[model samples]
Target: MKPYIFSILFLLITSISVAQTKEVLLKKSFKVDENTILNLDLDNANVHIIESKDDKIHFDYQIIFYNYSRRKINDLLDDTSINTSKNQNQIFLKVKNSLYLGIDIKYKPNFDYKNFNNPINDVYKEYLKKYYKTYRKSENLYKTKDSLIEEINFSIGRDMDNYIKKEIDNFPLKKPLKTDKKIEKNFIIEVPKYVQLKIKALESDIKCDYDILTEFKMDSFKGIFKFKRIDGKNNQITSSNGILETYGIKNSRIQLRDMYKVNIGSISNSKLKLEKTKTKIGEIRKNVSINDSNSKLYLYNFGKNFTKFNLTGDYSEINLYNVKDTNFSMDISGYNTALNMNGTKTSFGASKEKELTKILQKKKKENSPFLGNIEVLLKNGIINIK
Candidate 1:
């Protein structure tokens, strides 16, 4: 057989051997009160956590596998395990061991059956009928099936219609395959509104929303976290090579470090610690204190009644925008820094000046007596206030 024909045969055989399947690995619930804490450790999974009115904590862990044989799936099921234990008011859930399943490849052949059923085929059939109507007693040109196929090919080759010609030209003669692959594990966890979460995860995504939890803490390595409208007193998140995003935070303390990207929105009375991260804040309300290092921070806007803003960082880029409407006083102290306020640029520590300190005040109201105070101490960086 030809090499291409052999390749097609092998692909069809392989495709026929494997099938897509899903299996529930674990389904369990824990009885807890308002003060319960959930300590979870997982890898290679997506966790969706939401608040529930019920006092019990419910979680479902499952696996979705593709292009794998039943035997292989059974082997994987035997090898995977999740460990759980209860410790006082805290429930511990951890992944003991799991084998890495090979990536799944979804193959699609280039040949489309619907394209072969074109209107041109119907026209050719009509022509065949009309031609045979007149030559019924005479020697027919399409005497055998092979001769009919040849006539169809000839007609398609000689067609002048652009649509038909383009279709024929674009259609692949060889049944080449297109492939895509994805591997996913998912967990849906539901807990009480007042419960706390302590999670340590790797290469996983987590999403939570709309709960007045006591605390939300996670130490993740290489993953994405998204929190929407979550209210808490002490919510701390730390990640390395990860993305952290929050839509709303209220009266919370958040510590984030070593993140690739960070986006925080509409926070009030919060304490934030950032290190080696690229951060963006949508709005600051009330008061906020930030301590950062070797990062870039961008503040988009401020709330009307915000009274305090303090930032301390080194080797960073700090940008504050749209603060001209607020009455505030800024005390900046840093060395080897570039300060740009209202397009006025100043450099520090590059000349004879050492440990320079500059004070700036913006008063949009009469007799406001500095409604806000902005303090910044940074080294070897750029600060922009406008």
Candidate 2:
């Protein structure tokens, strides 16, 4: 078999496979009311659930957490939450139906910490060691050195202030504590107060709408095949009878081709009004004024060269209002070729020169050597002997 033939066959197979195995990604957010129990299975890392609530809101949650990685739950928790003290690390409670006014359960890297090595203490001790070393060295130098040492001490003090400020800025600031204390006499100020509670309740079945979003990359091939229109209404199609149609040929390349026929049936009180605008190629516009109350449009594309072919079709249906102010036009061209062998070499030639000439004459006449060459090719082959 020829290389081009194999290439075309492989393209058809790949296109069919791709069409069969295509998937879509969807992402959405939903709001749940307060006091709702959420049962989540965290077996899949791609799936997650989060909860939030106001003062009057309460919620019970049952989640089966799974760690696909080799790391333990404690390690994951430690990574997710910040630990300020060397000896103290916040522990996550695990039980069925642990109720809370608000609960957020998604993967948290910093909070997943449970191990022999305490990162918080290790980091603080390193900082303290550096601070003490610098301070002690500077103090000793101030006592031993001359007047230049005073300037050095001043610089050291400024450096220490800046370092402390930066460290303080790095620390996470906690929210201020709220309190209510009534004073006996002198000017008592009144303030509103609300309390939130976290409670534990039994796990119950709840309807959960799960939405998954994912993206996959796969290798595939693509090809263009011809499609035929089975039915039409209110308009006449030039290629209505079963015929091979091609559109737009540039540099010996067929831009578009339709292997199927186009058929347009009768329409009642049908009118086709087209308005055209000048473009780089030519005038282009919208086609309106064809309205059929009871009619259907049938279309199909046929694949050749291979027994079975995959087709991907996309169509845009435009509904136009007010035909008096509408514009539309169409430009189509193509090449039809037949292969012939003269001696040992094979040549390709077109088979529709006179037909194309008649069609072109109906639209517009353009006298060009390029078209004349095409006409000659249609009569003979790509090559001819005198």
Candidate 3:
């Protein structure tokens, strides 16, 4: 993998501007091999990739430009960018955040209103006291054209309630007057420990305690991988609201595409493919296969190459707890769906068991050999795996 392009530099040229707090220092040094294949694509900012025994590949950056301006810091020293590509053991980087501000400030709301359907005040005092009591009982009637139409409805209802109480007493509740424009970039990368990281982020925040990778591709948009530990054995993570706190990758083969709920903690000897994701889960250590119409997945631990769990979703849901005598194999079908499994040497197969929803298995002591060949294909939704 080779591709590097960066025109617009910083790091010892010591002649900067931006009319305010300004500083830039981006040290670089690279000389690969020993399993080097680093790739990073960043956005917003806050990343730190560590692991160095001095094998090479160091980058110490420090950029600050608050409220920039000076022709946008000289058009970021003239058209900013940092894109790269390298091969024969790969190394590609792309960074962007060219401290800008050439001149742009457009705000709205010059204030002007006339009662947008009773702008508060108990909705104009309960509909103006029943509309002036039905206009004084329909002008009671005093001849002379009903007393000149009740003096023109009491002078247009007291001048439309004083122009709606002067537009609710001049609306404009503070704030807003902020000429926005700010930029800041902070990163410290030092590679060479166990190389193999393919990360892509947007509104960034990443930290990796590298362990010499083999393969890891993470695509996060609204990023956050705090205190991450990499152990790539063909690991793939595709995220939106990114936040993966890896404990220490091992026994791998995990492919996850998450959007909503599924905050895993530990995984081992993995084998998973979670797509269109969100397994209403908090944590699961392995063994999974899911496909969703929307999203929902959760298989409470069975670590060490977790015993099989295959799920297919529609309007999904599967919540089960550590059943007593756990011997797994549940092939569920879907409709109005619901699978609520409990415990006690749970055995089933033969169609419908109803001992008042069985729950009488108590002398138990055995912890997860992790077996559950549970196969569920849902359309509507319910599979009580007990």
Over 1-386, each residue of candidate 2 has an lDDT whose tens digit, in order, gives: 69999999776654331111111122222222332222222111121121223322122222222221222222333332111111122111222221221122121112113542645445445555776777546532211112322322222112343344445445332111122111110111111111111111122111111110111011111111111111212222111112211111111111112212111111112232111100010101111122111111121111111121111111211111111112211121212322222333332323445232111111222442111111111222121110
User: What tens-digit string does per-residue lDDT give for candidate 3 at 109-212?
Assistant: 12223434433434445445765666446422222323332332222113334333334334342222233344455568888766777888876667665553
Per-residue alpha-carbon lDDT of candidate 1 for residues 1-386, written as tens digits (9 for 90 to 100) = 69999999776765552444788877888999877888989775677788766888887877776666565567667776677788899998876335464321122213334566644445445444654565333321112223322322222111222123434444343232222223446677888877888889887667775554477777888777776655776676667787776666777666667887676666787788878888767777788888888888877666666788888888888877656665666677788888897668988776455555553445445665555667888878788875
TM-score of each: 0.70, 0.12, 0.31
Candidate scoring better on TM-score of 1 and 2: 1
Q: What is the C-alpha RMSD of each candidate to the true structure, in Å?
A: 19.6, 35.3, 22.8
- Best prediction by lDDT: 1
Ranked candidates, highest TM-score first: 1, 3, 2
Off by over 4 Å in 3: 1-21, 36-60, 68-178, 186-194, 198-213, 217-232, 236-252, 255-270, 273-288, 291-309, 312-386
How many residue pairs clash in each candidate at the backbone level? 0, 29, 27
What ranges in model 1 sit over 4 Å off?
Answer: 1-19, 71-79, 96-178, 341-345, 359-364, 367-371
Residue 83 lDDT in model 1?
77
lDDT of 3: 0.51
